[model samples]
Structure formats: structure tokens, C-alpha cells
Target: MWKGLIKTNRQKEFFKKAERIAEEACKHLTKTDREASFSYETLKVIKDVKYPSMSLAKSEGGEGLSLYELLLMQEKIAEGDGAAALSIGWHMGIMMELSQEQLWDKAAYDRLVKQVVTDQKVVNRAATEPATGSPTRGGVPETKAVKQGDQYRLNGRKSFTSMAEHLDFYIVSAYVEDKDTVGWFLIDRHQAGLSIDKTWDTLGMRGTASDDLVMNDVKVNEGDLVELKSEGKPNAKGWLLHIPACYLGIAVAARNDAIAFAKDFQPNSLNTPIAEVAHIQDKIGEMEWKLMQAHSFLYSTAKKWDEEPEQRGLMGSELAAVKLAVTNTANEVVDLAMRIAGGRGLSKKYPFEKYYRDVRAGLHNPPMDDAVIAMLAKQAISKD
Candidate 1:
């Protein structure tokens, strides 16, 4: 879709450097104590660098990193602040998927990637409805798109539209009944009939402003439809490697905080640091071990997807497993971080409470944990 990407050794090194910069910039999100209260200025810094375009490849104005390198960047960014990382992670996934579907063009992608590198202008998929849950492909949409001459009219409201107010565009999924099938449309915030119901004051990911998108009769060109046949594809990969990668990073961020906190933490009334205590040490050890496992699994999964980047039937089951595992793992890690921080952790003095809230959303996020497990069970039985 775009050209002149970094496929050389220098470019790969640049990607690593960009990730390090993001890590250094975002490191305080976990330690903020009251992470939800964080302002948008922090996210602005990461966006300015267009670090989200890590998947663009040097040819398309990005580093063209393999899945392993991509995961490395995600882990580093999430370690900074899970919510911020999570907000950005969905965009990373979106851009990659758009490119894979041959929807991204040099004009929009180039300009957008440049601004994305450094701005708070988020790009995300707005498919979840207050009632529809995961908005999985083939899952009937509460929102409908009606064809009106050359343009389409979108009318509906979406919940958990992450980064709503600050985003540049929303790649929305709605049912286009004229086709007797569902379809996706890219709606720009600047369009008429589109408004943000600025009610996003999330307990966690507060900085993300995961607000609501209300469309009365937003008109957009049919050309804005990024993927014509993407919705009901055999596998419906809406929640695949992308979203999980973000939460996966956020989960790791929790682990990173726990490790750092324990290393220097002094137990109340005890003469030794918490790291010296057998029990605390044990918990920290578990956090570390678990984090390693997540890293291995997520990295392996991304690599496999990239290896066969075009094998797009549907990996709903696999994506669900990743989301469930990482979300659970992230929740545990943040919980443990809270425990390690003690009551002070819950206090607005550190990020534990906010992380707790943010991590909890993963449980409710589409590809719900229950759904994934059930699917996995079915897959197992079918194989048997």
C-alpha cells in the first residue's frame, strides 16, 4: 500500500531504538499510582513519534519488523503504561489488518502514520455495542448502515469506543442490509452526524477516554469501506493478535511494576526489604515466571501469524485463547502488584488501583474469557 520501508539492518536497529524511547517515555505510567488520573499529554509524546506504525514496514514508512521485533516493541511500550499501551495497541492491530486487506493507501497512511508517531490522534475499530458484546464477525450488529446513492449513512451508538474524543478515525463494523451481509466502514470524526458522548471516565484507562460514539446519520463514501469481505470471513479475526497484543503488553507492564516495586520495597515492621522475604520473593518469582511464559506464547503466536500472514480463514479460537490468557495473567500481575504495594497501592499514590480497574476490562472485552474457553473446548472435542 505504501513504499520505501526500512528492510535493512539499520532499519531494524531503528525500530529497537524507537521502542526504547517509548519505554523510557512511558515508564512512569505503571508507577503513577493513580494511573487513571493521568492526563493526555503523556500519550501525546508517544504518538508524535508515530511509534504505532511499527507494523508499516520500512517500505510503507515503517521499520518492517518481524513479529518477534513487533512483540518486543509492544512489551516495552506496555511496560510504560498499560492503558496507553492498550489504547495504542488496537491501532497497531488495525493498521496491520487494513494493510493486509489492501485497504490502506499511500496518501492517508503516510500522513496518518507521521502524525500517529507523535499525536494523541488515535485510530481504532469501533464495533462493540452496549448490547452486542464482542461484535464478532457474523455477530449481528445493533447498528446499521444504509446505502444512500453514492454514500452510505451510518446510524448507531457504540460503547467502549476507546480513545473516542481524541481519535482521528474509527474503522466501524455495521450491517449493510442491502448486501444482505455485514460490512465495515471507516468513519472520520470530522464528518457530520457523528458526535462523541464524552461520558468516558473509566475507572481504569482513564487516560484513554474510552467513550461512546453516537452516529445519527453520518454519511461517508462507500470507498471508506476498508474491507468489503472482511466481516464474515471464515475466521472473523476482529479480536485476534492486535487487541491481545495491547493487553498482553499492559499485563506485562503490571509485571514490570511488581518486579521494580518488590526489588526496593521494605516490608512494614520488618528490617528487610520485601524482596528478601521468602513469601514476597515467591510472589515476585511467580510474576516473573508467568511474564516469561506470556512473552514466549505471544511472540510465538505473532511469528506464526506473520509466517503465514495470508492464511486468513479465521483464528477466532486462537485469538480468544490469547486474550483470555493474557488478560487473566495481566489481572493477576496487577493484583499482585497491588498486594505488594499494600494499602498504599490502593491509595491514589501508585498505579495499582488504576491497573486493577484497567485489567478488569479485559475480562469483559470481546472474545470474552468464557466464550474463548468454550470455543477451545469445542475445538478440542471436534479434534477428538
Candidate 2:
């Protein structure tokens, strides 16, 4: 817990609120982020409790949490539901960049931030295309944003959009209007011609509603082009990896779940709790140990960025290292969680199945481990 977050006679109440949110989320831990379904009740709890606004500056109606502390907050919530953690993470992570860069008209930023905190809206980045691939791989978008009178017409098929269906607005990527530039347009989902093409069938993050965003000439005003660039490095936007932090939180959550389960969950033949089993205890111990090491590497790097705000954008080496380390741990921790669940883990009724699929998403995320290793090797050899 970061110092001074909830300072009042209400410290007990705050923890109670926090615990209640975790409890509510725990009820749906098995739901697929792809569930992409809306829950007014759940969303209301999040807004009232204020986790979406966790990263927002207190001065700007946010919690004023530092990046490192925000990461910790994300970890705590994710221990309950990985998808909700990420759905919220995507919004906060984007806001951090907008604030850092001072993009958009002040009014829009203000309204957007408020909506995020209030649960009135959600924003996501749409950057993938069928012909190309992930925006991560330097794939240029076939999606075109054409400038028209008083507006821009955007046409594209974007895949792998996180939280696509539920978004109120999307900062969609396309070849710049009649140019070779990469452009990002902030188109509202309510605008005509923007539609969710299909429900995503991803194995993980199912509750996130990670769906395909389709635009067959969506119209947008100049206000929509929040960012435009003729040329730049693909990795210039480093804030994207804040998402990995959310995934890391999921691992932490699974670790906690396993430990608590071990305390009382008894197998058919076991007269006592599984905590008494040496092998089970060892598995739990090793997972905790791995989490500590992973945090040591991750937290230090995050703190370095916060303590020195000048460092922004992704360094292939550092970001890759963070992604590789945390994601792998998430996979392992979740596996141990499933193993602890025994045969029950494989069933849909068990949250372990959902956690298993969700954790795998980390491994596939870019910068893929191989890419990171190769880049690190190059950097090491070159520097040496």
C-alpha cells in the first residue's frame, strides 16, 4: 500500500471497500475476458471504489498514484480478475501517455478522464490489421484514414483489439490521410459505420471483450485525430507495456489464491488440509520465491522510470525484459494454481481454467521472448 492514499478515520472502511471489490471480482474470476459482456453492477462498483481512476492525478480527479504504486494497485485487483484488471489498465495506461505528452484539447482530456473514472466510457487503441499483423511487428496498416471536408473517413479491419466491443472511443491506427504516415484517430464507437465484427474467441482475457473492430468508412472530425506522425520508431510508445504490469498482477493473484486454497482444500483421501503436504507446500513456496524475484526486477525498473520521469518510450531491451520475466512467471504461477486444484482445475467451473488461458496470453504478447533475447544479445555484444 502506498503511503497517504486513504488517510482518514476511514482507513478501516477503505480496506473494507477494497476487500469487497476483490470479493465481487472473485465471484467472476472464471469468466472469459472475451465475455466482453457489460456488467453495470460490476462497473458501478469499480467506479465508486475508484480503481479506474487509480492512476489519475489527484489534482485531475484521479488517485494521484505514482507508476510504481499504480502497478502495485493493479496487482492487488488482478489477483481477483485478470480481465477486469486489464480492461481498466488499458484506459489508465492510455491516460498516462496522454498526460505525459499533453495531447488533446484540455477539455477533451478532462471529459475523457472523468468518464474513465465514472465508468461512463472506455477507450482502446486499434492498431492491428489482417493483411499486415500486430502493430508491434512494424506492420503497416492497410487501413486508410482519408481526409475529407471537415472530417476524416476511416476504413479498415483491425484485429486483436483489446476491449474492442465495450469501448466508447478508439484511438485507431491507419496510414495517414493520403500520406505514408502512421496516424491515430480517436473515433467514437457510436459514430456510424463502426461496428464490432465478431465476438473474439481468444483463449485468455475472455472477459475483456477483446473483439474485432471494423470500420467501413467511419467519419470523424479533426477533434478525433489526437495524434499524427509522418515517421518514427515503432517502439516510441513505451507506455504500452504498463499492460504487462496488469498481467503480472494476475500472477500475484493466482499465487495468493493457491496459498489460501492449500490451507483448507482437502482431497478425497486426505484427512487434513493440503498445506500439510510437503510437495504441495514446496510448489507454493517456489511460486512465492519466483514472484519475489520477478518483482525485484520489475519493480526496480518501474521505480527507475518514476523517480526519473525523463525516461519514456520503450527500450527494446528493458521493456522486453519486463515482459518476458513477468509473463513467464504468470504462466508458471497459474500452472501451479491449476496443479493445486488437481482434477477440478480443468473444469470450466473452476477459475483455474480461466487463469490458465489468461496467463498464456502473456507468452504470446510482443515483444515476444525470442525477440527480446535476440535484441538483448545484440545490445550486449555491441556494448561489450
Candidate 3:
């Protein structure tokens, strides 16, 4: 097993469980990748193991695993299947954020936290829109909600709704015309006029089923409208570290696979395995260096967010830096691993090709590269 930085016995136990899940999930990775299919069976396996509740607050009958621990588990799971990790990471991260921030109404949070613990119900925010792009970009949502006699009617479409097929609850963001602000509504899957558009076809992370969520005049109770709008940028969200952790997992998987192949494959021209070849050894060494750099940046940032509550709000720059550095480094690590794997790396018979594609998708995830760089530059100039 690769070296890990698990902090507690509870975390260690959960990490072992994640390892087992990853091992089993790997059995279907090739087939699922080939078909570009979503796997409810894989999700069921995760739910059956009660992995989603690991991040729920202990006060709510959960393990309340720390952000660091959660990221560790996310990375391990992604090693087996990137889409599975990315799919469920949203639920895990959202649950952790809600627990730590207490940003939701008591009744609403209590209602959902119970179901999460008792039923393994999953939830994700439907904030991205076809017209507005990422909500983080500060685009007011085109989805609008109108108050109607203690109920609110919502209408608009959401894009990149990952795990759309299985989410039990969707915390949708929409504009409230009367309030002149954005509001979040917790809508159930069975709500009328709410449907999945099956539009998530992509070159990578295809199994995420990140389809479009269609809401045509869907209505919800007043109590369901949980949070109101905030101006300027939102607060730092440490839970988003899961994004970098996940891609790093994919990179690590590629590195391990390359090493295994190099150690086993003895070319006709070589007296020994290619693992002894200087060029291959150089690539392996470089992969190790990059992995170590990314692991340090990601885990240290996560550890700080967990251990220092006072510093949490001030970690916006650090969070973005971790995501940018780890994701780009992960891409590098995977590329080097593919080099070690040679021509066979691109074959359908090998996993490196899939790793190459999936790791690149990390570049497109939230706290995007350009945004991160611009934020960093602004911060630097302000300091000067």
C-alpha cells in the first residue's frame, strides 16, 4: 500500500474501508469507461457501505470525519474510479460544509441530516446554469423563483448537475424577483416539472452523468427556500479541496500502474525489466517528486482548515492555490506515467489512457486555473 497520512484510528479504519471499495470498483472501471455509463450499482455499493455519512456531524449520529480525512478517502476512491469519486464527493463535501458552517436553517438542515444518516440519502447543489456558467463566477442565476402563498414556484435549467440520476435532494439556486436576490431551494427529486436532460456526454469523467437539470415551474414550500443571497464573493469553502484530492488520486493510480508495468515488462532488447532503464527510472522519479509536492500542498491546506477554525475564513487564497497547484501537478504526474507506459499506455487494454483523460478534466473544475491565477495576482499586488 502507498504511504498515507491518516490522523486518527477512526480515520484509519475508514480509509481501509475506502481502499476496499476502490479495489472492488476497479473491477468495473474499464467496462464503465468504455461505455461512458453511469453506475448506480457502484453508487449502491458506496451507499451500502454508508460512506456518505462519514462526513456528517458526530452530534448527528455520524463519524464527522475531518476535512483532511474526507479528502484522503476521496483520493483513495478516485484511484479506482474518477467519476465515482467526483460523483459522491459533491455529497460528502456539501455535508461537511453544512455541518461546519451551519449555514442552513435548523429545520431544513435537521430534516436532511437525519435522512443522510438514517437513509444514506445524497444531496448536491444545482448552482451552475446554461446561461450563467459557474455560480462562483458571480453570475446571477437565470432560474427565478416567485413567492406564491407560502410556496415558491421555480423555473430554469441547471447544467453540469453531476449524479443527477440519484440525488435525493437538490439545493437549487435561483433569483427571487421580489427580494431582488438569489435564494436556495431544497427541491425533492419527485417534484413535478423537475427532470434530468441526459446531456452530460463528455470526453472524460463520463460516468458522472453530469446531465442538465430541467426545472419548469417547479414549486416548493416556503420552508424549502433555505438561504438568501449574498453580495460579492462567497466565503472560503475548504470542502472544495476534494477536487484536487480526487485528481491527485487519479495521478497516483497512473503512477502505480506504470511502475507495475515497468517492473514486469522485459523488452526483447533489454537484458532486464524496463524498470531498470534509466529513462523509465527518470520518469518514475519525476512522478514521485510531483506527487509528493501535490500531496504536501493539498493535505497541508486541508489540515490547516480542520485544525484552525479561526484561520478558516482567511484560507481563500490558500484553497485556490492548492487546487491550482495540485491539479496541474496531477496532470504532469499522469503524463509522465503515460510516458513510462509507452505505446501500450494508449491501448484500451491499459488504464493510463483513461487516467490521462480524466486528470485533464480536473483543470476544468471549480476555482478554475485562470481564476486562481488572477486571484493570486490580485492578492500579491495588494500586498505590495
Q: Which candidate leads in TM-score?
A: 3
**Residue-level lDDT tens digits of model 3 in 1-384:** 247687568877988878877876777787667666667678778888898888988888778888888888999999998888998999999998898889888999999998899989999999999888888788999999998998899999999998898899999999988788999999999999999988877889987888889999898999998999866667899999999989999999999999999999998998999999999999999998889888988888888988898998789999999999999999999999889988999997889999999999999999999999999999999999
Tens-place lDDT per residue, model 2, 181-299, is: 88888877789998887757766777766778989988888777777763555444445566676677777767766777889798789988998999998899888878777777677
lDDT of 2 at 88: 68
Per-prediction TM-score to the true structure, in the order listed: 0.81, 0.86, 0.97
Candidate 3 scores a C-alpha RMSD against the true structure in Å of 1.4
Query: Over 4 Å off in model 3, which ranges?
Result: none
Predictions ranked by TM-score, top down? Answer: 3, 2, 1
Residue-level lDDT tens digits of model 1 in 1-384: 001233457545645654664565465554432333333565556555656665665666655556555555555555566566666667776666555555555555555566544443568888888777766534577888898998888899887777777678888888897887767787778999989886665566665667789999889886776554443335545325545555666666566666677787775788977777888777777777776666566666665676775653555566567778877787787777777778878765665676677678767666776777888999999999
- Candidate order by lDDT, decreasing, is 3, 2, 1
Candidate 2 accuracy as lDDT: 0.72
Comparing 2 with 3 on TM-score, the higher-scoring candidate is 3
Question: CA lDDT, every prediction?
Answer: 0.66, 0.72, 0.89
What lDDT does model 3 reach? 0.89
